[model samples]
Target: MNVPVHVLKGAGGKAAEQMAAMGIETVKDLLFYFPFRYEDFSIRRLEEVQHEERVTLQGTVHSLPELRFFGKKKSRLTVRVLVDGFLVQAIFFNQPFLKRQIELGQHLIFHGKFDKHRLMIQGAIVKNAQSDGAFEPVYPLKGDVKLVSLRKWISQAYKDYGDEIEELLPESLLESYKLIPRAEACYFLHFPQDMAKFKQAKRRMVYEELLMFQLKMQYFRKQTRESTDGKEKSWPAEKVNSFVEALPFPLTAAQSRVLEEILKDLNSPYRMNRLLQGDVGSGKTVIAAIALYAAVNAGYQGALMVPTEILAEQHSASLKELFAGYPVTIGHLSGSSKVKERRETLEKLASGEIDIIIGTHALIQEGVDFHQLGLVITDEQHRFGVAQRRVLREKGIRPDVLFMTATPIPRTLAITAFGDMDVSTIDEMPKGRKPVETYWAKPDTLPRVLKFIDKQVSMGHQAYVICPLIEESDKLDVQNAIDLHRQIQEVLPHLHTGLMHGRLHSDEKEEVMKEFAENKVQILVSTTVVEVGVNVPNATAMVIYDANRFGLSQLHQLRGRVGRGSDQAYCILLADPKSDSGKERMAIMTETNDGFELSQRDLELRGPGDFFGVKQSGLPQMKVADIVEDFRTLEVARQDAAKLVASEAFWKSEIYAPLRQALEEEGVFRKERID
Candidate 1:
């Protein structure tokens, strides 16, 4: 089954090149080229077929096929067939060569969609003489590769080379799961005899894919826990209590509990690989600050990394204020730092003068060293990958890592995506944080929304006008920020408006954010650049244009910008949703302020791929299993993988040799360090 592609019949240089472009270079690839859809072609009499119904008919050709040309590059082959005393005409487009093989009075079978009004079939397929009445599969295709040629090549390869395919799953697993042999699964997937066979084949493939993924995740989890050793620093109760009392507000119950969990992990011997999840404005940062305080009190250093420079600067200022009365020294480093300033910060860091440093990816840059770095905490952890986290941890021997994210992930996804790390959830929000009132409107209702913004601004409040794009796109009809700024200025000439986007310079972005935070800019028209950490408590009104284009979690984040203060806040979603999914997404935003619920709904609606891009999720692309639709299968696979990894006999047996080899070749075990 691993034979060269050229060994398959009809796989010449051109065909092989096309196949290679589609990630198919071997006979095994051909066997795994699963179909996107299947069409029922079981035999049916012509007279019994209804209009617009797909059917397969067998009969004798009434007349010879005729080839007709409509233009220089357009041609069609027309043929007549008599089936059960009914006459039907079949047409094949751009297939003039079919006229040579089809003969008058010859018995043939046709499979296609029937048109009873005209008694004609638009697209028809002539079955091979040896083919029986079976379902037809429609495959994902490359350029210029006809379905007939691909089908014939697959059939020939299966007949000649299928037996050579080696099964990777052990016999015990197969028997327990009731899975068919690998070769038969491949065959049935492409050319199933019936619906039952198709479902069984698909089930086996999905289970295998999920099982491999779970096994790899569990293996990495165990490896990282055993191979790494962390600092054993204790959190003194009086020190933690004094730090909490110095804070501006009392800690929420949820935050206090999660902080206890972090303390327990820090005192343990194993490197802490933990994820702290909370909703927007749920006070996750305060918990991180407390953990960092414990590290510094224990005569060690801590580091906090964020995704954006603005966020880094914000954290630096906030941490300084939080540790005002303490002896801890906080340093800030970013890409935009001056040369002398960065050098001085680096030197201070190396000499252990700085107890904690807050920055962006600049923290991981060369020449940045820490003296006894004990803890590493990353905010908005999804923006960074496992490798980046490992690099930062490498700066120290084995630092305890706590990753914080405000974008809540559903529990089901957290198990598969972040199964390697322990999870902590801060489900409660701080007191006095009111849920922002959300509403939906169409384009015609913009006047009412604009009036509301004007009223809010008149009340000494600010507003945010968010657009999906900075510039106009010829392909998309959504309004751009630049144009929207102009329109807002024209509509409400009294209000001061400013524009900000990713294209702006770092200094310019910082200036705009500062102006907004100081209540200087009453109306800030921008893109999603303000989605993360640009917090302005005075901004009470947010109008998102084309809101349907954004995901539910993202819309929630944008809404979080407002409602930060004690005043009533409003988020107006201006969108004319065209699809049912779009409308549903908009409705979900209006229905709930809970991030975890929205995340679950978002996963169910957009699936994991769009929920978190493939790169951020750190999950390998699946071939057969869908993470959303096959959650039950995922659970089963996860349990089975745990059992397999726990059994030493299974790992040492010959049946698992191929599985291990396949995993190694795929580099599953050698992926980024979980820590």
Candidate 2:
């Protein structure tokens, strides 16, 4: 019986269950889940090893020590082992299992790096058989389980089911690429006979992974184009221009260009799907307001959906002011909005009394309907997925969709994920805004920085002291909001302080935020929740504690918090690392402020996994190809997928018949059904 692949991937439990969520459901996925690094366990003979050195020996146990408890917490067991006439002492902690495996005068093989005073094998898996072969295959396993058993299980699993897989690529392409067969790739990946086979299989598996991804993207793009007519109803420029002129800040040239593009999409009868991504404070909200202005003027309502209530309120207030004194009616609906008020808002929306509405997910909830919501706008669109966007689109007469994000996505990634939409990036920041001065600070610099915030506050400026964690917990040691709040209260007792985090109730948060916005509080302590919203123009300093705890894009976003106003803003990244990656993150912080540049730097520092981990980066994994190294292979896969699809419509082609059947084989995740 075939259970859902999700159920099977979870059969292993806990550690691997997440693979299903990542769309790694089949033997093919397991093959492509390549190891980030390897633990080399090749052993040298005891004669080649000195005391306190790591040495792998193929010898027998000459003597076994008694397995006795030295203390309630410590189990003492030691034995003298002979490696070609050289004596070495082996020890185990609470490991009678090792004693059971090796009897006195038993021949066994041991491989581990040696230390200066004793054998320093941090993690070693031993076997009872004696051999002088090359390094054995090791699988990624956890707990107290030994590597030998993992090797055994994998060997058996593959022997029983590996032969079921059929090659999914064309014969000529596979031959020219020198790619391994699907079955052999799976076999070698698990238990490679040699290094050459491991590399050979890895190359083929990576390419196949990318090819399958490209195929899925191609299908999704085609489906989207067919479903959308690219038709839009016209909204005049003078109407929106008059509204823009009435705003406080003049619309920048980039913002003007985006408004025209949106107007073009709106005027056309064809459905419009577009991604409008920009850097922080690049005036995307202004562009959105212009488009919404045009939408309401075109005799239809507009809905602006944001991820959180604070953002919704911000948009509603800004746009409400922009549309004020006009014929269009504007309102908001959020979780905190009272029931009677909500009912009235819904009525107004349903009856077409409201021309513009801004709210969180509450806008999409039941009872909220639009008589003619011709357009749906999602702010910080990365927070929602294609499904959520589809729900918004369906709410009206196939409303033209506009998605706005501050995180500038790489173009390749935008194509793969947002393939259904045309992408427009507002790369320019407004003039007169100075670049944020970023610095890598040590723990010792904390007091001086607090002094700076103190100075800023003293000079009538508010600041944001952000932490990664909300509160103290046993699981993690990062400085939480609660702890830092107390620490700051004690140091800066004269100033009023307010704390905001994810755990607080909605009303409670709104109240505290209102106090901060009204300047009732001089300094607001917060978590990453304040990364996107709660804009206070007077807040001049944003000091992020443990900045390395966040990804590059996130750190940049946090920095963006302070630079909003004309005041000299500073972003201090506090990190002292024990690893190279940590140091690299600090380097990225100092390198460039451009989100696109930072995104590529981040991709180089991390990988496709990082993109998935922080989907907000909006980078697409460009096929089984490495954007950094495998461009040639990726280009080949792209050409092949395009050629085959164009030549005979791969969805129906004889060459792709088996591949189509393979897609149905349940081992796949995020499979795109051919239309």
Candidate 3:
């Protein structure tokens, strides 16, 4: 059944190369090249067609096709067709060759959008024969692959190799899930008789995809839990209490609840794989600090890995302040650290002198060793891949792992993407944290906004002016951080302005952030690099230029930078959104400050692609399943996959053999075993 694309009809030379460019080299790949959308081309009478709708009509040509040239390079073909006693004009733009195919008194089926103003059909297709009342699939195409050529090739492929494809799901699952046969679903997905059948076919395919993904995730979780044994550490309640009581502020109920959950996991025998998700300024660091304190009290070392040097430095400084009176020693490691500093830090870490080490990816470098490392915590977990996390955890013997993300994700998507790890959310902000007031303004309000920023600066508070781009771009019309920094300095004249962006060197970024944090810089103009972990409690206002260019979650994170302190914070969005989506994003930012709610709205508005990079989630790319649209199907599949993983007899059955082989081919089991 693994036939090459070249063997298919008309797939030769250039055609074959085009197919290969789309990753369709085999018959299996062809089958999985699902359509992005479908169009209905069933024949309809002229009277049945609606204005501004796309439809197919069978009619006889009443007038010969005439070509008219608007200019030297542009020409259009027009003809009149008679259908059910109604005459309608058909227009084809830039297709002069269509004049020969359409003739007077010839019967043809036309498909296109109906324009009521011109009383014409802007025809995309004009076939000599009638359609068979079936939906036409619109596929994602590559270079030189015409729709007609692809359609013919696909038809020939199905005729020659459709029967060779074996069913991937078991008969019991098909019956229980009310799913059609795999071969039948494939056929119906490409050419459905009606919308109902298409829906059923899509459902079957989506269910299969989700089921496989969930099975793999569950299998990895089960394998890891059973194969790896963790250190049985005692949770000294007194020590944890003392650490919490020493905090300058009290913990919210949500934080307390999540901390209790983490404590339970640390005391358990199985190595912990947990995800700590919270909104900005939700106090996740305090929870992590308490866990590290418990690990150190249990005679072990802990390491916290972050994504950037400034974040690592920030965490180290904050932890040092939090553990000021404690006996625990903290070490910092980053790419910018001097050689002597790194060497001393490593030596201390290996000798058990450093109880807790905080650093960036530099902590995972070769020769960096840990003495009695019992816990590993990664901040902004999405920034690191599975291999990086594994490398850090391998520094110790099955150390408990905790991954934290301030980027709030929709609950359903979190379940689908991070199904292998347990989840804990700090839903409530700490006491004295004020909700930031948000507003949306146009570009004309810049002068007023600059004046407001100056006012905040004069009151001994800092402000962040965010730009969408780091530098000037000929392609984009938005302001850049570097350019905006100069403009702010020129306009404000008296305020101390600083620039921060991702392109700066690590040490340079650290210095800029340090200045901003110490109140030396009253107005900081930066890019989204400051969205993650730059904490300045004295910052009171934020002005985001072209705010519509940012996603809702990103806008929320930027807004979070200002509201960390006791003063009332304000977020001003300066954007003139032309699209509905852009306007909706700006309005949502102005409406609420809840990250979780905004995350759900963001998924609904921008889809999974913009919300979370699918490639970075470590899940297989799905052909039919959408983590946002098909969340119910995902939940069902997750439950079924868990049940299958729990039942030993199912693994040995012949019905499960094919699925096991498929999973193995995808390297799911290999990655599990290696990790």
Candidate 4:
């Protein structure tokens, strides 16, 4: 089964090359390459055939085949077949040699779209008449790989190496799940007798794929908990309560609960790998601050890494104010840090003078070093890659990690993407916070929308005018940042407006954001760069142009920019979407303010591939199972895998040898350690 695909008959040279291009290198690979769909060619009687229906029928030739040439290398072959005492014309295009295969009084079969009114079958596939017809497997093709050759080669592989494909699951699991043998499922996937059998085979394959994936995830989680040792920090509860009481605002109930969970992990013996997720303005940073306080109190340094420089600066200022009276010393590092300041921060961090360090990716550079790191917190966790987080962790002795993300991930995605980490969600907002009111307006309503912004600004509030593109493009009719900035200044000439986008230098963006925060710029026209970092509590109005061009999660994040203050906030969406899906997205944005709901809807609309970039997320590419559609199966597999991996005897038992072998073959060990 492991032999090269070229060993199969008629699968050498060009065929082998094409198969390799499709990721089928060996006979086993060819067998496991499932078809995307099946063409229903089941034989049906003449009386049962309907007009324009695709079907197969057994018949005998009633007339000599005629070949007619139309143009260069183009010809038509026609024959009359007698089917159950009725004559029907069968036509084959571009197959002139088929005239010799069909003759008068010859028994044959035809599979094609039947035209009952004309008693003709067009584009017919002629075969020697058989008692029964089969459902043909339709595979995804590459290059000039012919479907017939693929079918023949697959059939040959099945005949020659069928016995080598053994059952992977044990009898107990098979009986409990009502699953067929591995070999039978593989065979039926390519040559199913009926739709029922095909569905059964598909269920088995999907279950196996999900089960294996979940088992490996469970195994890695077990390894992380049992193999690695973590610091058990014992901070003073009274001191923590005092620090919390000194804060300007009280912690929400959700934030309190999540903080309790994090504290428990900090005190545990194993290194903690937890994910802290919440909606916008949910006070996640406050919880991180308290956790860092505990780490610092435990006599170990802490590090907070964010995506952009603006966020790092915002967090630095806020955390400083939050810990103003405390004895903890905090330092900031970034790509644009001055030489003297960076050198001083590095010296302080190395000399144990700084208790907590905060920065962007610069915190992971070689020049930076921690005195005695204990806790690692990553803000906007998805923006950084797995390798970056690992490098920061390697600075300490298996420090406990907490990942913070504003993007609320769906449950299915959370399990698959962050399967190895314990998840804590801050679902409640701080008391007295108002939900941003969302509205959809057409381009023709710009005057009224601008008037609304002007009113908000008159009340000592600020506004953000978000555009999809940084500059004008001939291919797109949407508004650009620069042009929109100019237009806004022209329309509201008295209002002070500024421009910000990704193309601007980092320092420029930082200055623009600082001005916006300080209310110097009444209206800031910018691109999506402000989607994550900027925190302007005084900004109460957000106007988004071409809102339909963004996803639900993005629209929700953009809306979060405002509504931070006590005053009411408004988000005006300017879009006239032509497609039904785009219109639905706009409507959904206006219907709910819950980030989790929006994320689920986004998953449904865009699927897992687009909702989360699977390539960037470091998730396995599943060939059979979909995390969204097959969530129930995934749940079952997760539970079963967790139970099986927990049993001490299961790991050493020979009965599970095949399962272990499959895991090894998948290179599960080589996969990056989950955080």
* Top-scoring candidate (lDDT): 4
lDDT of 4 at 530: 88
Pairs with backbone N, CA or C atoms under 3 Å apart (clashes), candidate 3: none
* TM-score winner between candidates 3 and 4: 3
* Model 3 lDDT-worst window of ten: 666-675
Q: Please, what are the lDDT tens digits per residue for candidate 4 over residues 1-675?
A: 999999998889988898899999999999998888777767789999889988888888898998999979988888999999999999999998898777788888778899999999999987656545567789999999988888899999999998899788888889999998889989999999898999889899999999998988898888777764898898889999999988887888899899999999998888988999999999999999999999999889999999999999899999999899899998999999999999999999999999999999999999798889999999999899888988998998678999999999999988888887789999887888889999988877988888988999999999999989999999988899999999899999999999999999888988888888888899999999989988899999999998878999999999999999889999999988575657999999889999999999999899877876766675777876788989999999999999989997568888888998888887776764554
**Residue-wise lDDT of candidate 3 within 293-408, one digit each (tens)?**
99999899999999988789889999999999899999999888899998999999999999999999998999899889999999998888778988998999779999999999
lDDT tens digits, residues 1-675, model 2?
122333332235642354455444554454444443333345565455676554566666778655778667677567777766766666666776676767888876665555636533433346446444553554444554345544543454455555666778778778888887877886776666667887897799778866665555555554454565544666676877778788887777887788778888888766777889889888898888778778878888889999888888888888777766888788998988998999899999999998889988888776778899898999988787656766777889878888888877765556445544678888888889888888888755878888888999898888888888987878866788998899889989999989999999988898888898888999899999888876888888888887768888888888888877788877777776654556888887887889888866676666646754554443454323464566555556555665665555566767777766655563332533311
Q: Each model's C-alpha lDDT?
A: 0.87, 0.72, 0.87, 0.90
Ten contiguous residues with the weakest lDDT in model 1: 666-675
Q: What lDDT does model 1 reach? A: 0.87
Q: What TM-score would candidate 4 get against the native?
A: 0.87
Candidate 2 C-alpha error for residue 49, in Å: 16
Error of 4 at 85 (Å): 26
Sorted by lDDT (best first), the order is 4, 1, 3, 2
Error of 1 at 669 (Å): 4.3
- RMSD of candidate 1 to the truth, in angstroms, is 5.2
Q: In candidate 1, what are the lDDT values of residues 474-563, reduced to their tens digit? A: 998899999999988999999888899999998999999888888888999999999997878889999999998899989998998899
Worst 10-residue lDDT window for candidate 2 reads: 1-10
Q: What are the RMSDs of all candidates, in order?
A: 5.2, 6.4, 3.5, 5.9
